[model samples]
Target: MQAWDDIINIAMIGTDKKQPDTISVPASLAEITTRIITGSEKNREEQFLQLASLLYNYQRCGISPLKKETAGTAAPVEEKKYCSTHAALALRDVLQDDNHSLLQYWLERCDSRTQIAPARFVPALLINGERNKKLRLLISSCVGKRGEWLSGFNTAWDFSAKQTQEEIWQTGSLEERQEVLQQTLVTDPLKAREWIRQTWQQEDAATKLVLLSILAPFADESDIDFLEGLSKEKSKKLQLFALESLRTIPGSPIVLMYESFLRSAVTIQKETSMLGFSKKNTLQCKLPDAVSEDLYKTGIDKLSSDKTWTDDEYVVFQVMQYVPPSFWEKTFQLSAEALLELFEKTDTGKKLLPALTKAAANFRDRNWANVIAQRRSVFQKELLPLLPLAPRDSYINHFFAKNINDVMDYAKETDEPWSMEMTRLILREAAKKPYPYVGFFQKVIAQIPVAVSTELSSYPVSEDQYSRSLWSGMSEEISRTLAIKNQINNAFTI
Candidate 1:
């Protein structure tokens, strides 16, 4: 070890500046170190390399094992039943495939059936739960007494161990601490806020970002002042994050301010036809001459990053993105459909349309989502999840023929099981153009209902050799995944 330390010091000082003759090895290693240094005719760099390699191996190979201790008490007997063999095998397949959604479904089924994972699978599941904090609670519930007992031996698996929330908050890993904060937020948000407030200054930047993110979903009037305070912090990222979180809270002062600004900055201009029979409404956007101190304080920038829009248009876009689409509807006294129509006619509409679309998705305004879906524009794919099942399915089906890739994207994003009709449509499209859809087949495979697995064989095969090969592989994977899912479903049947 002394020789190793001396070698490091020499290396740090550089071979040219210091020689390797100064290395001091233990009596046991001295002979080997001397031979390595003088074994051949070499320069200072070569002598240092030989000495470093010799001491490195000596230290590594000489490491002493800890004194053995007797094993602790045995794990307590588990009252819970083990999952079915079929279910365990399905789980193994899911785990090996690294399919998170399937794993979630399996855990849910295992927990709901009052069965714990097989003892052999407990470690893997616990390891997964450690990596993905969201799964820890579910995994803890399903891993049973044995898993908890196993977790006692490994510090990384401490999430499965019995510990008070306060203990976990103080001493747990970042993931574990986050899980605790998330749970605390649900049970006692004020306490959670207090905890973050107490530690705000001490936490690192990364920790601060994650902890602040956890507050977003549970953010309310209580968090407004704290978030507003964060919005003014020196870190631009934290400032933007705080502002975004504040935007989610409907009546937050920042959102109210944005709404107020937009109410004046944007408006509807109505015009009657020459015959006075028809009326028309156009969106009128009044650009601000300069960015105000109030706007800058709320994290809005003065300059435009977007080449297409001016600084004013970009500022308006940024402000409108935070204000809920419902605000525009209420301010202008128009339906979502009518509003979209007006936005379509305006020169500023291109910049603001995307903003309104984002606001609809962010606020989860279903009415706005419905109107946005009607256009079948770029925004439709983003808002597909917010649309009702019937409309979403209809939209995908209508657009499938013209643009299969877009339909695939919509399906992948929603991650919802396609209707039987839509499934048939997908198969028909794949049969025609198997190449484009092949890559996405595995991703959407689980979304295919089990009943449709039987229909895979009936689809027409592509004539092109490359396309046929792709379809064959994709169809087989779909069948296999569906079969496993079916087995998982049936294994849980009472």
Candidate 2:
């Protein structure tokens, strides 16, 4: 090792700067090194290269095999039957194409029938599951005993392995620990909190941030004290994250303070019509000339990033983002529709409506989402997920003709199977603009239900030559994917 280190130093200094005669080799390799350098009439650089090559080979060849423990016992007999050959072939195609949605559908169907993945595909499934957390549980269900057995050898797949949750929490990698934290949070949040509390001091800042995020969705009144303590952390990002988590808890001190501030800063006033028969509610925002110390401590920024809006407008925007949209409804004593109507008519609406839309999304307020979706100027595609199935489909149906690209964006967000009516609508529209949007269609092929395969078959051919070529190719791909999906479904049934 010392000889190799000397050779490395000589190499780093270069032959011109340090003579090749300075090179050293292990006792066993010394003879070969001398032979390589002695009779060679080569210059110092060539001699150095030769000696370096010899030492590198000697070091590599001398490496001792790592002393690992005994090979584990053979995998146990699988309780579940392997999937049918056709189903395995379908899985192979999905994997080969790297089509995640279809892969999920395949795993779901296989698990529904209580069949394990083919032995050959278990490793690939486990590897994919390692990268995609959403697929891990599904993969665990369908990969069955062999996959589970294989997981024991690769710690990366420990989520599917038979290790106890406590064991994984203590010894697993960061990802595995986070997964365990999430599962424990769902089953026993108190225990999860205790674990984080015990390890809080030992974790680095980044790890603490991740652990805090894992607690966000499951955060409750019990977590308020812990989160409030973290809100005072020196790390700005960690402190901000803790504050954000507290905002999600309804009665947390931060939320109560935010509510108290907003209660005075924003108010609704009633206005009478000229005839004095009808009344309208107007949103009146009165931000402080300066952001108070208390408000600033709650993480409200003092300046507006948007050049068009003043600092005060931006401050109000940040406040609205944290408070649930329902707060506006309760405070104003108006329906979501009426409150939206008020926000839209005011000069302040420009800044507040976006924040309101964001709050609707953040708080998962369906009523506010629906009302906001009705305003064409303010609606965002991000709101699609908040709408229930019937309303979402209706929204898409209403807007699909003018906003084909938007519908494509929504398809990318979700893996839910399309209804027959929506399927027909999308297919008909996609055929009309097959050049670009058809490519988007190819990605979402799994979302098209199998029942629509018949419609794909009966689809009319285009009259134009160019359009015909594109549709023909698109139609064949759709048909083939549907046929494979059908085969996968039938294989599981049998």
Candidate 3:
């Protein structure tokens, strides 16, 4: 028989160039090969095709692959804590669909209770972790031993890799350095501070501010000298960073400096109103009885030209922001609640409320945030992040009856999941008012877990065709979205 290599050789040049296969025949194929090689039974190309067909038939029936040595090693089975089915399904559903809001919820649950997600979910989590920096820690925690093993294959997902923290600090990009610095501060604040101190003068203004901002967590009187030195810098941004860091450590010299400056200009005053017995006396925020030429230049002096408020009122608002919110409680001889309430009664309180709430949000005082929510219809948006995550699933549980869009905006800003009660509230309101965008409502609904929204499955019932048509269409969208989610739930671990 002709060798297979000889057949390949004739095929390479094509029948047009040379007809080696047609010119010669193997001993075994001498009879049929003679017909194609010498006979006019088929032309050169046709003859080549017939030869190829015979080989194909022979190989399928005759050829057999030899048993060979084993291939590359399988990935080691990681022994790790497996998440519950509910948790696993929840993670998969949110992750696969790009439901960031719910993914945030899932990550939070994993973080709070040390829940490890399924191995299958790790790869996707790693991919997503590269997309959003904030989720890196939570994703790392959920990734388990197997996921860590997988991260080495992709540089983007290497957040969990252990390296010389100093290397990252010295050579990493600004974002990379900040991430390393944040972790360093958590583990060893002194080392973090030293790193900043070494690079302080060498770094540019933007980098310097970035480094200074992360110092707040571990800031103390020890950091005061460095910050004070920064205060002397010509860059206003640099000086602002120094002042902000100083405010974190209440007893720091910088805060004390501001405190001393304000001690004389601000004081508590009680006023008596003789109009009615019910309105006898209440405290008022009082400024200096007399103003001197020195007062106007310092923030201690009233300084705004706008008629909306007095110069003294404007100055007090500015001073309240810098000083600790606690200072007012002691200065006014009122508790935080009473002080905030007393301020609410005055027009000056309305102007100053934002500043005081800012201090509260910065200091992470929940009491201050709550009291603001109590008295005012609106609270500072920044305060929500200072609140804990994965709050028993229903903490921000109800949507206010009015201001549906505002409530939704607040929910998104906080990155917290809306409770089913809240979702139901939104749907019920939509059924009544018919929210303008069906697609937006559909997307938001998809993020909510099927389990949580079980009771809200059926909604917006109506007899009128227009109203009925709208509700029915929205219901169908929810149905289709949840049906796919249900399929995923069945297909997934939890």
lDDT, candidates in the order shown: 0.79, 0.78, 0.65
The list of candidate 2 runs beyond 4 A from truth reads 1-74, 84-86, 92-101, 112-114, 118-161, 183-191, 272-279, 288-291, 302-312, 375-377, 396-415, 418-479
* Top-lDDT structure, candidate number: 1
* C-alpha lDDT (0 to 100) for residue 363 of candidate 3: 67
- Which candidate number maximizes TM-score? 1
lDDT for each residue of candidate 3 in 215-332, tens digit (9 for 90 to 100): 7756777888888787678899888677777666677764565566566655545555666445422334456666454434333445677889777677766666666778777666
lDDT of 2 by residue, 197-280 (tens): 998999999999999888887788898898889856779999888888887777777777778778888887889999999997
Candidate 3, position 135, lDDT: 70
lDDT of 2 at 478: 81
- List candidate 1 segments past 4 Å from native: 1-72, 84-86, 92-101, 123-137, 154-159, 164-166, 179-195, 275-279, 288-293, 296-315, 345-351, 375-380, 397-448, 457-464
- Per-residue lDDT tens digits for candidate 1, residues 292-340, read 5887776688788778787777888888878888897688787888778
Rank the candidate models, highest lDDT first.
1, 2, 3
